[model samples]
Target: MARLIATAEDFAFGPAGKLVTVAEELAARGHALTFAGSGTALQLAERADCWDEVVACPTDAPEFEELVGSRMAAADLLVSCVDRPSVELARKHGLPVAWLDPLTWWWGDEAPVWLPDLELCVVQRSIGAGDAAGPYQELPANHVVVGPIVRTGPERRGDAGSGPLLVNFGGGEAADWYQPGRDTNYPYVIIDLLLTQIDLTGFSQVVVASGERIAAEARRRWPDAPVSFECLGHRDFVERLSSAQAFLTVPGLEAPLEGWAAGVPTLFLPPSNSSQYVQLDEFRRRGVGDLSVHLRDFLPPLDLLSAPLRDRSERFIEQLRDFERTPTIRTEVAARLSDLLTHPEGWMPAVRRGHAYLDELGRDGLERCVAAICALVEREGESA
Candidate 1:
């Protein structure tokens, strides 16, 4: 058995979830694994039990580099979720690294000197075509375009019935900027807006599967609403998503991909990051999902706040304020949601297109990824 270290920036569940899936598969195949990340990544690594040790390697921590270096020194190989520091550190230790990039957004921009030995990109062919005519085209030593690394849930029972509208906006602590501090908090602004403009008589149930704090805040805001707030574990979250009839979320890769895998239509909110914006744009271009509504359309502009919001980019803040101030924004958003829920058939074209792409990509990406990692390990043994 070979010892491997897997690392990612402690951003959200997407990176950590992918690493957990790979680590679990490798562990089941008789490999020793350690997971090093921050925030939700560390939390998930511990809960999943896919790693021998779960290390808190936050980027801002003073001894982050020392901790990562110490772990890499003991491992025969490294598999990372496309972090430059981890990749460089693994190379410094002369360990082969497999970089798993689920978004495929890491073009050859400002890359580190020591690239990964294998670059496994989890995206559709059109996204990972590598057709950029320049040095960027041939960036990695071994570039492989794999399917989306989605977490599978139990076979959904036929009697699950029409599930609630599953809502999630990635993981990690919610930013305070989005919080209005009224009765509603950040991230649930849309829910509050919908509540004001629409009767919600047509919909039976709404579920928000974010963290406990968000769920608690949601309940505090709308105590009488039919919405149920839950902070589920990874497996349960996927199960809920699979049985859900529709989705309302930030346009991140994992949640949208899960929604597509389940063949449900999603109504997206404006993205919180540049990578998400790009990916969501691609989804719109490909007719995989509907275009997201601007944040201003759902709530009052951020500039109206007396003080600057923390933990948000100035550019995003500016964009949020850039929308034309209009009194009918809530009515417009309500109309859009009404159309989406009442006439679900209008969304079938996009839903079918997304499912078809997922079908062609196949669901055995984790198996293929495991095989590739094992091959790399065997090759190192042969060389030794």
Candidate 2:
């Protein structure tokens, strides 16, 4: 069995939850796995039975480096979600590491630079980082393009609201990060504008998932709005996505990926003239969902393709949104992911052969890309 140490050390939402899910799956396969980190990660590690050892670092322990070094030496494989002290420690010990790809508009210079250094970089195929970075194409060839490994088994049952618009914009250890940016002309900004333009009386509920300050502000502004707010675990969040009608947000890689998985139709707001727009284009090509330039642009396209959902309640709307993100490719990604785990030498051939649609898209075009995603998802279900 491949002994693994899951590094749940990121502050962001991308990888921490995914790492826990991967650890559980790996443990079910009988691999020895441990979790090491501080802050909220300590709490998560405590609840997980998959972990062989939970190394808790003090809030500000000076000997943290030495402690992490010792832990890294103990494990043969260090599968990480976050990249910080954990990435550096993995490097010092020469352990294979898996880092999540985060490429949104807000990312700084460091995002692309650090990802390449890891022994294996597991990225969302949607991020397009595989094509952008020379390291993915040139260097040690450790990049593994796995769809974000999410919890898909079951969800807590909740009666979803039909007319109510559930806006979930925050979930993580700290809720303060998803602050509404007034200046950025992103989807969040566009969402705010559309909410105001529409008749408030038409919608039954306006649920907002966010920090206390933003939630409070939303409630105050729309006092008559039937708004409910609560913190949700990962499973609950996925269940909510499964039940929602339509999603409005910046065309982020993660949200769209989740929306696609649930088959929920979405309206993506991309920065003008960005390559990021390509992600949404692929979603549209698959008949997965729609996109808009702004609120006004949305009305016409939505009126044309989404008559069934046009005047529906939030519950009905959410149902309409569930349009099958990319079919279901969990198995193919997992198979490829497992191949990398079991046979290290096989990485280059699979990547070079453009395993699945990645290669087809490279040779063919957008149509091939869509076919690849569909094939990947169906094949995963078959294998499972």
Candidate 3:
């Protein structure tokens, strides 16, 4: 029974998705585990409620190293999802570590130095192909490239029934662009536009999941619109998703990947952050969604994305502001929603295409990661 510490970058829910899945599998295998995160990742981590201790390790905390270093000294192994600092700390303590990366195409020069023997790199593809958005570094013998890493993974739904429409306005914060006050800023940009143009009364039992601020706004706007607004934990969100007739959300990698894994029909709302914009582009390039609507059409200069991370992120924010301010874009979003609501089953054909894309890449990432981590842990223990 090795002691394990797992963590994910707090930028979005996607990294936490990978963290919790790996931690859950390791815990079920009789290993003691701790989960560390902040922001959306922390929120999702607490929802799992399976950890021996869940420490809130904010990256900017003055005692961040001390907080993480203490855990490293105690743990037998470190498992990280797109979090480099934790891996570095574990290596500093001379421990075995496994790194999970879902955005291999985006990190470029920011990735950590590979430890040939003691670390295992599980690099996952963002989409089918054409993800060479930035420079990619090759890995050593300890690395394996795989597809999406999802939880409670069961491919092919058993007849998606007339379940409620799952409308997700996922985590609202990213680096400098998003903060506490920014909750109702976007996706809501489209939602506000949506409510004005289409009456959701046509759809029954609409469940909109997001932070409290967003939920409150939805409730206030459509007091009698027959919608149930909620702030679901990671596990509860998945429970809701499993039965969803169709899904519409920000184009972050995790949620759609979760839907795709379940064979749930999905449509992407516009992205809120740079990573999501890139993800949206890849989803469109692959033609894998409920009639893919590429945001790039509105924001020309796809070359802006190839710029440095900070520059590109700023560019996305500017363009999103323009998108919100534009009358045509508001109408475009509303029209898309109205058309989809008219034909509810229209998302499935594109979802089948999504499944075919996954089938092309293979979805054994979770199993492969678990096997590698287990092997790494056991080998390290034997060596000690």
Q: Tell me the alpha-carbon RMSD of every candidate.
A: 5.5, 15.8, 2.9
Q: Select the stronger candidate by lDDT from 1 and 3.
A: 3
Model 2, span 152-259: residue lDDT tens: 323222233344444554322221221233212222332344454333343345455533344455566656644565444445555666665444433433444554
Error of 1 at 6 (Å): 1.8
For candidate 3, which ten residues in a row score worst on lDDT? 128-137
Candidate 1 lDDT by residue in tens digits, 1-384: 998988765555667767777787899999999877766666667667667887776644668768877777777788887555677666667777877776444343344444444433333233433335523254455666566676444433322245567777666342322332431233555666666754455445777766555667778878887678776666667777766666777777577777776666667766554345455656665666563564544654443212222323444544533322344654576566666666666555766787776765567666677888888888886786
lDDT of 3 by residue, 1-384 (tens): 988888888775778877787788888889998887677778778888668998896755667677878878888888888776777667768878888878767865655656456468787766434445422345577777766677635544435445577888776665444653453257566666655785465444678787555677767777875567887887788877877777778888678888887777787777777888877777776778445455666657455546887787777777777777788976877787677765756767877887888776667877887888899889888888
Candidate 2 error regions (>4 Å): 1-3, 8-11, 31-63, 66-69, 102-118, 129-139, 147-164, 171-206, 211-225, 269-289, 292-384
Question: CA shift at 54, candidate 3, in angstroms?
Answer: 0.8
Kindly provide the TM-score of model 1 when superposed on the true structure, using C-alpha atoms.
Answer: 0.79
**lDDT to native, each model:** 0.62, 0.44, 0.73
Score every model by TM-score.
Answer: 0.79, 0.53, 0.89
True-structure RMSD for candidate 2: 15.8
